[model samples]
Target: MKTQLEELQTQLTKAKQYGTDQETLNKNLLRILKERANAERGIIPKKQHHGYIILCSQQLIKKDNIKYSEAVTAWKTQIQTPYPLNLKSSEIKDQIFKDFVEKNIFIEMEICTDSLDIKTECEVNLQQYLFRANTRTGYWEIELYTTGEITIPLNMQQPKKNATGSCSTFQKDSIKSNVR
Candidate 1:
């Protein structure tokens, strides 16, 4: 009777605290299970981040002959696009929250201070139940469990060097922007 009562209490507790979309809940549950397995194996799990973006080359070249490296050869005319440290979009936040709940899908991301460092390999996991979005200020705060950053050699030179911390400036560069 005590075990049955305890089980019922656990279910009730879960019901009361769950506020995320149903899909994300499923993902969290799965994550918990996996974490438990890792704990048993004595392998400390590393963290992934809440968000990250990828910039691919824009120019595409057609290939006359197919080869093993043909796919990459197509994008010869391309600039190295840097990743956005933190994206502030309602659409992205919504998508991430939903994806996390349903699939526990965590996108790769780097922290703001270490964007230029090539050695910084960042992975992201949305910290459960800490997502927040403020539209007025364009601030989207989401707690992410992450593997801490490390100093790495700067390989890819960034065209746009943002201020060290999150800045509120929109200073134009000497070169005119292509934006309309």
Candidate 2:
């Protein structure tokens, strides 16, 4: 896994150095996108064109050859960004890719919810294992937070009335229930 990831990182670096040119950049982006999508969704390339590529998983292609052009278009667009690919920005991009890669890694990992506690004031303590992947390294974070009460503006949900009696009984009931 490490070797494969390293090779991908090197390829990504080379692709960035190749600049915003159409052919070289798009091809490199397609390669990286294919690998990442395959890792995430078990997809494989079926055909390639000058500006587009078709991808489908082996099973799906064998069954019906359903291609996802939206995925290809998104990948192509991301790689051809005009911005300089610095380490910080590259790291951010890699983080997004890593998220795609590590999604399934947590499927079998048991969530440790034994430490969670709920308070009477509508406050709840939550802990969750977040898995993230990128060009550089995979990431795992145990996020802990307390969810406090949420308040929505009443005017956004209902029209304001100059007179209190302008609101019907049903409207009063809806406001009591905090429902629009």
Question: Candidate 2: RMSD over Cα atoms?
Answer: 23.0
Q: Which ten-residue region of model 1 has the weakest summed lDDT?
A: 74-83
Q: lDDT of each model, Cα atoms only? A: 0.33, 0.27
For each candidate in turn, the TM-score is: 0.20, 0.16
What lDDT is reached at residue 21 by model 1?
Answer: 64
| lDDT tens per residue, model 2, 122-151 | 322222222222222121211112121112
Q: What TM value does model 1 have?
A: 0.20
C-alpha displacement of 48 in model 1, angstroms? 23
State each model's C-alpha RMSD to the native.
Answer: 18.7, 23.0
Backbone clash total for model 1 is: 10
